[model samples]
Target chain A: MRHTISVLVENKFGVLSRISGLFSGRGYNIESLSVGETIDPAVSIMTIVTTGEDLVIEQITKQLNKLIDVIKVVDFLEIDHVEREMILVKVAPRKEDKPEVLQLAEIFRGRIVDSGQTTYTIEITGEEKKISAFIDLIKPFGIKEFVRTGKVALAREGTRKGK
Target chain B: MKISGAEILVECLKKEGVKHIFGYPGGVVLNIFDVLYDEKDLQLILTRHEQGAIHAADGYARASGKVGVAIVTSGPGATNTVTGIATASMDSIPLVVFSGQVPTLLIGNDAFQEADIVGITRPCTKHNYLVKDIKDLAQTVREAFYIASTGRPGPVLIDLPKDVTAGMSDFVWPQEVKIRSYNPTYHGNKYMINQAAQMIAHSKKPVIMAGGGVILSGASKELRELAEFAKIPVTMTLMGLGGFPGTHKLSMGMLGMHGTYYANTAVQNSDLLMGIGVRFDDRVTGKTEAFASHAKIMQIDIDPTSIKKNVRVDLPVVGDVKNVLRDLLKTLKEIKEQQWGAVRSAWLKQVERWKEERPLTYRFDKNIIKPEFVVEKIYEVTKGEAIICTEVGQNQMWSAQFFKYDHPRRFLSSGGLGTMGYGFPAAIGAQLACPDKIVIDIAGDGSIQMNIQELATAVINKLPVKVAILNNGYLGMVRQWQELFFKERYSHTHLESGNPDFVKVAEAYGAVGLRATKPEEVEPVLKEALKVKNRPVFMDFVVDWKEKVFPMVPAGAAIDQMIFDEEKEEKKLKAVK
Candidate 1:
């Protein structure tokens, strides 16, 4: 099962390595991982999506929590959460099909970021499934280039959990 | 403190408590070497080949349980270290390999001595870094050390572009790193510990299959304790040799391809196999489908991926072997000494019977030298006290079968990678680590040629390493296979005509060289080699070319289906007589 874990760690050097060292040493698969400082400069939040069984995930969380800089680890799957993904896609659209593509983009609440004679750049933000569906619907138009920020999530309202 | 990347590299070494580094100089790494020259606290050993430097680093890591460090140049220098890096990666040794790269501006242009070292080493290293900015050098070096030494330790490469090495920055080493994706678990859960204890208590005929992890985790005592407490017999893989005392009644020598008959039989018949620190490589388990089919397996390994990579495990405990064994020892009830004694005695009797029936002995003629005799004599003289490092081929197997290694980390060899030139440099590393103890490298004629350049390193350092070269005048192992299954049509196995006089070569390298042509000369030459206190000695023994390691289970063959010595066509007449 794929799980997204949100970890709040002290902003320090070598900490990124200590965590990755753990995964590589244990031979665990980290499908997508991204880390950056939060609004609080002292702390950095890392969202890691990995695939493993329950025991593995639990063990990963425990080990992560034991790190000197790690303050917390939250498995978003177990908690009520708001998940979102943003995708920027460029499609080579024919001149005649531009109207249909624009109409479809409007229905999906996508914005036209850039347009060329034969290409249209579209930006969409929504839940992972919505973005995936939007990409699937636009596939017939021929995607020239695309990039998606693999799902970033946060705890739902009124459930402020802290490690 | 304000520092350059080169200075930061040395400072990181200081932080890691490194006293010695093995490396060579080149265009790109000149700055780092210059800085190292001024660093009085750090000792550097210059090697002739980059491969030798890396292998020495590997040996150092294996011997000391510290991250072995090596520095090489760009392109060919970096490429030369690939084999050593791959060998370390395969064996899971902790190493930090630093290679210089072309400057940032000239990187894509394929400048002089330029190579994409990071890309080349990515698959071989646990992790790697191509330092583009000088500011990140200190952090990268620290991270490299941290990654290389932690958890399931393996080599990590740092490719520093020449511009980065020469670039100056405010270098402050980071105390900690914040990588969320990499976290290795060292401690086992209490519930799992209790469950493992229950499994051990329930198993009537249990056996412990230990591997290199025991040595890596420093769990030999714990492993022995667990085996004694549960009254379980122990069998080790090639890498696991010396983890359990070979003289111990419960120690069932080595198990797998060339393993003892009793060890293989014990593993086949056991009701439960408690594998601790072993990956269950193919050489250990001949046919994966039928291997330990009747036994309930309990696998304990630091790397979680290794648990189900081979044999299926009924109970998988993923944690450091030492920590897991420590917890299990605390929870489990010790077996009664009397009961354990009876079980050990019975197993020992069976092993003795097998040994008597199929003793590892070879006939020695007055005219011809035999490799088996040389190994046996070495064992007799050393009393199995010295660490035996072996090169690949016939000599490696003979040493594995004959040399009785009763302690962990004492039988250091390239088991996983099977690198040819590993023996000499590894022996050098082992000797450096344990200067007081004896270190021997049993190498083949072909294998020694691969890294014979290290004789200079050994001679210059006065390492007192005793190298016993089994000269069969051919690629003995491959020739044996061809003789057995390929109608004796030797393709490229011959090495008799065109070869350097090893004795003269050793002398040229400032080491004593002894040649043994007759069987009787083997023991005396080895004794003479051992007596060379400060200078290294290489004894070349011309052994029989037709000799083959027996009890052979051909590749992809089942354990039970093995070809004993007497079954060989030439040996059949001797058996009849």
Candidate 2:
């Protein structure tokens, strides 16, 4: 089973390691992870999606909670949450296909970040599945390059205080 | 102060307290080396081969428990360091390898000295980086160090394009890095620790199997205390050898392919096996299906991938060995010495009997110097105190069998990758890290030639490394296999045609060289070699050609199905007379 854990850690040197060391040292697998500083100056939020049994997740949570810099750990699976991911896709756009490419971009609510004579960069943000579906739709146009920010998540209202 | 990425790299290295870097210079790396030249406190030892430089760095990392640092040029230089980087990755040694790539504009253009170093090394390294911008250089250097030295330590590579290194940028060292995917667990769960303690407390014939992680985690003391407290006997993997005092009564010596008979037997019969910081490699468990069949296994490791990779576990504790052991000790009650006495006596008796029956011995007359005899003599002289680093092939196994390592980190070798040329450079690093201890590299004739260029580095640095080569005139390990299983076709195993005189090679490199053709000369030459304080020495021992490591259970064969030496078999026949 995969569990998404949201952690608020002190933004400091070696804190990234303290968290990852817990996984590698204990033999846990983090399938997908994304971390970034929140609006707060001193706090960083890390969303980690890992696969393990209930016991393993409990152990991971307990260990993460013990780090001096870590303020909290919440398993998103147990709570209502909103997950978002951003993806950038650069596709080769033929002169004849420019209108069609723009039409599809407008349908997906994506923005053309850059344009060249032969290519255009499309930026989209949504749930992972939605972005993946959009990339699949654009695959026929020939994707020159693609980059995705591995999913970052936050718990929905009522879940934070309940935990 | 504002500085170039190249200078910031040096500054970050200074902050990390790095005193030495082993590498060579080339076009792309010149700017970094140029700035490094101005840094008075940092010392750079240029190696003839990039592979040697990386291995030396890895050796330093293993010995010091700090991240070993190396720098090299792009393309061939970066590719050359792959084997060493892979070796460190497999063994989980902490290392930071920096390579210079072509400038940003020249990338992907088939430019001079260009290679996709980051892409090539991504699979091998724990993490890798390609500095596209100069502004990220300081933070990248800092994160590279932080990642390399932390949790299940392994090699990390930073590929800096020449433009980035030379580009101007205001250096701002990031106070923190936000890498979410790389979180590592450190503390042991109180619940799991208590559960583990309960398992240990109730087990009747429990054994502690310590691996190299004990050394990495610096948990040797805690491990010893746990073993002593629980009255559990300790056995070690090849990588784990020296983690426990070999002379300790509770120590079961090494367990594996060349492991002691008693240790294997105990593992076979034990009721519970407590594996700590071990990966349970195939060598340690002869035939996995049959390995510890009678025992319930409790595995403790920091890497989760290793837990079910080889052996199944009834109780798995995923945390640092030191922390987990500390918590377990706190929760568990001390075991009575009397409770362990009966089991210890029986096991000891069995070990003593095995030792008496097949004492590690080989007959070596003045005419033909046996490799086993030479190894035994080296052990006799060192009293197992000196750190022994070995190259791959027959000599490596011989050293494992002959030398009795009682403590951790004393027996260093490339076990996971089994890289042949690892010994000499690794010894250089180990010697530098532990200056007070004597370090020896036991290498084979074929394995030594791979990285023999390190002779220059050793001589120039005045590293007191004693290189003992078991020259069998053949790739002894492969030759043995061909002789045993391949009907002795002997196609490419011979090294008689183009082999360099190692003594002459060492001498040419400004190191003392000794050739021991007879058994009588082995001990005296070894003693003299060890006496050298500042100079490095290489001793080439002309060992017997037909001699092979005995008690060999062929790969995939059952544990008990071991091939004894023919002479020993004949001796058994005569004993019947």
Candidate 3:
């Protein structure tokens, strides 16, 4: 099962690599990972999306806690959570189909970031399902380029998981 | 005054009260060694290999109940410590290993002698660090020692970059460590303790299984008190051999795969089984579903993850064994002792019947020496006074089975990792830790050859560690498995051709050498080896190659389903009566 996990760790050198090494070395599957500085600059919060059963998940969490730099680990499955992913797609636009593509972008609340004579670069941010729905509608127009920031998550306030 | 990272490293070690370091010097760590030239307080024992150094530290940790320390250089030096790290990890021995790394600027550039040690050791180490800056060095060291010695003690590593060691920074000693997420619960939950005490007070058939945690927590006194107070029979895991007195009437000896038949059978029939500090590894549990089938199992452990990870724990209490056992005793006092009377006596009589039915037995031939007989002789010669370390496989089991360990920290071995060539160097460290005690390594021919190079370290340092090599002409454990389960193919397990003349090898290292080929010669050889006060003596005994460890339980077999030599089993039972 795919679950999002948040790990708070000290902002020290090589901690990221160590965490990633743990996953790869132990044969745990990693779907997506995103890390950034937290409210305290001396620490960082990382959001990881992974798939595993109860035993595997328990092992991963316990082992991560054993790491000195790791401050806390929380699985979003046990609490209420919000997840987001962002994507950028460059779609080929025909002279006649340009209006339809613009209307589709407006309906999804996506912005056209860059444009050329034959291509329109559209940017969108939402939950994974919404981003996938937007992609499904635009793929027929010939996607020239595609990129995405992997899923990041936040647990709702007053859950397992907040100070 | 400004201090370099190297000076800070040594100073912090001194502050930690570390008296000895076991390691080998190399390219990246040369700068750190250069600063050691003027040091007079700490002694550095140079080992032949990085693996040897780490195993020595592990031995020191086990023998002294202190955090063992080691330092090694980068690349191959760091990689060689992996086996030792995993060994210490498996057994929960406290150790701190420091490895020299390439300079910070050259780390990822593939510079000379560079490796991502932190990446390699992530899975094995309890915690590890790579210091990219000089300022974080001191606090990191302090944290490493703290994490290594506290709460299910295990190994921790610090990767020191060359540039960081050469760079200067003002050192600030970390005062109090307050890790918000890393707190270990010392006292168990009061509710759980009361529940356990109530069960113990009412149990008609109760057994206590003690483990390595008893020794690691220094809770031997508490464990003994609880056992005697409740009139309970106690059995120990391989790692927990010395945690409870082996000579006590209530002691059931080692339990599990090669465990005594009485211990295994009693556990299977018990009504209340209390497992203290045991993880219930597959070897211990055998067939998990059938293990303790008649019992309600309770567990006390510091690691919450360990409780019920494999076995179904009925009453799980998360706390250090010492504190939990202490709390249980106190709560047990609150409840009035029950009058089990005939019920408890009948259970004890049944357990005694099991012991008399199948005692640990082996008949030695006058013409040929048996490894079991040799181990028994070593025990008699030492009068159960020597510190016993062992190599893996048949030798280790025989040592665990025959030689009784009555005190905590008296028996040390590579229990978890089962590393070959661990016994000799670890014996060196054990000798260094307890200078007055006699240290002996019970070894197999194939295993002793793995680290025989350490003989120089023993001779030069005048460490009088003894080696008792049981020469069975093959990797006896694997060979025994093949004979029993694989139709006796014996494929590649033979080591007779590559085996060395161990007696001569010991003499060449400026140590005494002795050999025993007949059963009558075992006692004399061991006595001679024990008397060598200033130097090590390696004793090689040629035993029957086809002999195997008895009372065997194949993998996945239930704990009670042990297979013994059919004829010997009947004869031994009759002989005992």
The DockQ values of the predictions, listed in order, are: 0.10, 0.06, 0.44
lDDT by residue for model 1 over B172-240, one digit each (tens)?
879887565467779887788888887777666677899999999999999998888667888888888
Put the candidates in TM-score order, highest first.
Answer: 3, 1, 2
Task: Between candidates 1 and 3, name the one with more favorable TM-score.
Answer: 3
Worst 10 residues of 2 chain B by lDDT: B334-343
**True-vs-predicted CA distance for residue A97, candidate 3, Å:** 4.6
- Misplaced by over 4 Å in model 3 are A93-98, A158-163, B340-343, B570-577
Tell me the tens digit of each residue's lDDT in model 2 across B1-577.
6788888898889888999899999999889999987789898988889999999998888777888999999999999999999999999999999999999999999999999887677657887778888887888888888878777888999999999988888878788875554667788777788888877766776778999898999999999988887778888887887888877877877777766666776788778899999988998887888888888898898876667667778888888999999888878854333455554556556655765666555666668998999888998998878889999989988988788887677888999999999999999988888889999999999999999989889888888899999999999988999998999888799996788888899889899998999888999999999889887999999999888876676888655556778887798899989
lDDT of 3 by residue, A1-163 (tens): 7788899998876789878987988888788888999989999988889999877787788777766678999888788888888889999977888999999998889999999989999989999889989999998888999999888888777767442
Q: What does candidate 1's lDDT look like per residue over A1-163, in tens digits?
A: 7899998887865568767867886899787777889998988988888999877887788667655457788898778788877789999977788898998889889999998879989999998788988988999988999998777889998875554
Question: Cα miss at B271, model 3 (Å)?
Answer: 3.4
Per-residue CA lDDT of model 3 for B1-577, tens digit only, reads: 7898999999989989998899999998987888887889988889988899999999999999999999999999999999999999999999999999998878899877788888888778888888888998989899889999999999999999999888898988888766665777788999999999988987889999999999999999999999888788899999899899999888888888988999999999999899999998887888999999999999999988788778888999989999999999999877875554454778878888998988888777899998999989988989999899999999999999999999999999988889999999999999999999999999999899888888988898899999999999999999999999999999999999988888899999999999999999999898888789999899999998878887887899998899987778778689889
> How does each model score on TM-score?
0.83, 0.80, 0.94
What are the clash counts of all predictions, listed in order? 21, 23, 0
Query: How would you order the candidates by lDDT, starting with the best?
Result: 3, 2, 1
TM-score of 1: 0.83
Report how far residue A98 has shifted in candidate 3, in Å: 4.2
